[model samples]
Target: MNQIRPLIPLLVTAGILIGGNGLQGTFISLRALQEGFSPSVIGLVGTGYNLGFAIGCVYITRVIRSIGHIRAFSALAAIASAASISMVLLIDPFFWFLMRLIQGICFAGLFATVESWLNARVTNATRARTLSVYRFVDLGSVTLAQYLIPTVGIDGFQLFAIISMALTLSLVPISFADRSSPEPPDAVRFNVKTLWQISPLATVGCIVVGLTNSVFRSLGPVYAQGIGMSIAAIATFMSVGIFAGVVLQYPLGHYSDKLDRRKIILVATLGSLAAGVFIAFVAGDSTLLNYAGIFFFGAFAMPLYSLCSAHANDHAKEGQHALVSAGTLFFWSIGAVIGPLFASFMLDIFGPHALFIYMAAVLALFLAYTVQRMTVREGVPAEKRTMSFRNLLRTSTFFNKLATPPSEDKPENK
Candidate 1:
């Protein structure tokens, strides 16, 4: 526990920042719906944020290096707080999209700062413990913060004000926590072709996840509201789906280690496909069925990124996990930018049920690709695999570094 003592302030900052960010996302979607924006327009807003997030992933490291970590973090937090409250200033869809874009950039920088600092602080011995603690804080904060929407009610200034205040308060903990800044994060070399050559299944799987999961986070609330759910029920619906992913991540990752990781990816893809079908066709207007379907959907779908990361790591050369991670995230961001726009268009045309249909279609294609790959190539031998499975969140490249155990072989000192 002593090793984790210094990280408390960082963890606390994560909880605060994530809680506010989580709440603001759902709140914005619900508010947009209430204001009579079409599903397609609302989806465009999601796309804008994701696009900005992708931009940040590519460039934030440079900013951190240039200005230093603490200053970068404080600036990002302040801008995010400003963006959160700015939503009320104008009710335009385009305006909201712009604000979300700024928020995405700010948040990407903020997470990069915190995660890189944490990565710099830990040794290999304490890596797993720190990861577990950080994961718990991230998941717990996001899950509980869903209720903030219903608590403040999304129709007024209270929720936005709360989001702003939360972002502002996040500044307090980290500002005082460490007097000296940690080293800047390593810049990600985003060579998509190289990552594709390393592991195509993992590459495609990350994209599929981005295509599907971003829709759920960005538009799930809109779907719930369309189906006549109460505001509180909407919160429960989103929370239930997110929290359920924890139940299956570890077990599936453990089994993947024992066998070909692609086989595990196939299982998860099938499960996600099945759940999407159930939600789209069978659930209909039944609240109970919707909740149950999403519960299973989240259980299967949320772990795909982590599984793909593990599978890619199994094949990555020494010193290349960071590159693999950055490449996969780049692909995932591409999907995130496109998914909501496409899904929302379908929602407008065919109604909210189209959301799951789109997801199921994407998963079905990914499943077929997985099967084809397994046939074409042999699996990595169990003895040759290097990295163990660790749960991952799509935060930053530095987070991936911390999750990966250091390679065992010593340097030759060239």
Candidate 2:
């Protein structure tokens, strides 16, 4: 506790920032539905945000490099606060889409700034513990934000006002902190060929997880409303899944370290496939069953990104962890941008259940791919695996470059 005392202010800043961001995301989904936007349009709004996030990953490094972390973080937070309020003023679907895009960019920058700042403070001995605290704060705050939805009521302007307030409040701690800002991080590089040489299964797994997770994050509220859930129930539904992910991540990661990570991936994917089927076909009308299914689904699906990343790093040379991490994030972002649009289209044509159908199909395909890859390549020998876990919780390009050491040797395509 004493070791972490110095970092408390930054952690509080993260909590505030994430809480506001979480509320804004869920609020947008519900509010857009109330405004009579079609499912397809809501999906496009999600796609727009992810597209902007991807762009931010590519470019926010320059912004930080030019202005430095403290300035860049403040600027992005202001933009995010304004973007939250703008949604209320501009009620048009197209206008909201634009706002979401800007919000995504701001969020991408905010995450980069905060995470890079945190990474800078910790030494190698404290890296794991500090990252654990950071992850707990992030997931805990997001879950808490969901419960706030019922208090704010989705239809009122008050929620937007609250979101803006949170964003504004987040800046206070950082502004007053005594620590100096970290040097700007290098830009993330995406090298597909090198990643493939390291681990093909990990590459594909990142993309597949991105597709399934983004669909749920962006459109789950719409599905909940379609199934006649109340606002409070929607909050519970979303929060439960996220909470499940947080609770399960450590256990699953520990077990994966002991076995072939691909085996872990296959089992998790299979569980995800089953959960998707249950949600789509067997959980009708019983909200408890629906919630239970989502909880289990989150358990199995949410950690796959970290699993894939860990597996890739198992094969990576000592200095190449950062490159492998960056490549995986690049693929995940690509999938995130595409998933919501596809899921939304399915929702439009076949109703809410189609969301699960799309997810189940993706998981099934990934399952098959994982099985095939298992036959092709053996897992990294236990003696050869890296034991320390690195946090890849946020989709910040800067974090990837910072986590990875500079590498002179690049793997040729297999």
Candidate 3:
């Protein structure tokens, strides 16, 4: 606790920032639906946000370098706050899409700034514990934010106001902190050939996870409403899934570390398939069953990215960790951009249950691919795998630098 005391302010800021952004996604989806936007249009709003996020990942480092972390963070947070409010005033699908894009870009910068700031404050000795705390705060705050949705009421301007207020509040803590800014992060790099050589299963796993997860995150509220769930129920449904992921990630990841990760991936996919079946076919009119199904679905699905990342790092030669991480993120973002748009089209034609059908089909395809890959290549011997499963959780673009080899930690590399 004492070791983390100095970092409390930054962590608080992170919770507030992420909570606001998390609420914004679900709120926008519900509000857009209320305003008579088609699922396809709403899906494009999601796609636009992800597209901006992907582009921001490539360029945000330079912005931080030029302006310094505090300024960059403050600027981005201000823009995000304004963007949240703008959605209420504009009320048009195109305008909302643009605002979502701006929100995405700002969030990418905000995440990069906060993570880089936190990275600078800890020594190698404290890095692991500090990051564990960081991850906990991140997941917990997001879950709490989902529950906050019902409190704000999805049908009015008050929710947008609340979102903007949270974003604004996030800027306050870091503004008063006494620490200096960290050096700018290294530029992101992606080479598909290198990633594929490292682990083909990991590469495909990332893309598939991106597809299914983005669809749920962006469109789940819409599905819930379409199927006659109350706003409060929608909140519970979303929060429960996220909370399940937090609870399940470490256990699933631990098992993957002990066994062939490809096998674990297959098991997780089967779990997802079962959850989809329950949600789509068996859980009719029982909210408890629906929540249980979604919870299990999130448990099995959310950890695949970390599992895939760890598997890839298992085969990564020295100094290739960061590159592999970036490449995985690149593929995931590509999938994110495409996932919502396609899922929205399905929803438009086939109704709410079509969302799960799409998810199940994807999981089946991933399951088959993993089985085939198991036959083609051998798992990394336990003794040969160097990266820790816990550390693999930090491979998201926000913490990409931490995944890099120690030799590359020099300032000159940045």
Model 3 over residues 1-414: C-alpha lDDT tens digits?
Answer: 877777888889988987787788888898899899999999999998888787777778789889998999889989989998988887898888888888888888888788778766766666767777777887888888887777767777898999999999988888766566777766666688899888888898889987998899899998889889999999889888777776677787888888887777888899988998889888876788989999999888888788888888888887777777778887788888899999999999999989999999999998998899888888887776777564343223657554434444343243
Error of 2 at 71 (Å): 0.8
Instruction: Report lDDT (Cα) of residue 314, candidate 3.
Output: 85
Better of 1 and 2 by lDDT: 1
**Candidate 2: Cα lDDT at 284:** 78
Q: What's model 1's overall lDDT?
A: 0.89
Q: Give the Cα error of residue 46 in candidate 2, in Å.
A: 0.7
Q: Give the per-residue lDDT of model 2 (tens digit) for 1-414.
A: 777777778888988988787777788999999999999999999998988887787778788889999999999999989988888988898898888899889988898888777767766566557667777887889999998999779877999999999999999988866467787776656687899888989899989988999888999999998999999999999998887786567777787888888888888899889999999999975789999999999998988888898899889986576678678887898899999999999999999999999999999999999999988888887677754344457557545433433232233111
lDDT of 2 at 384: 71
Best prediction by lDDT: 1
Off by over 4 Å in 1: 408-414
Candidate 3 error regions (>4 Å): 391-396, 400-414
Decreasing lDDT order of the candidates: 1, 2, 3
User: CA lDDT, every prediction?
Assistant: 0.89, 0.83, 0.82
Tell me the tens digit of each residue's lDDT in model 1 across 73-110: 99999999999899898999999999999998988888
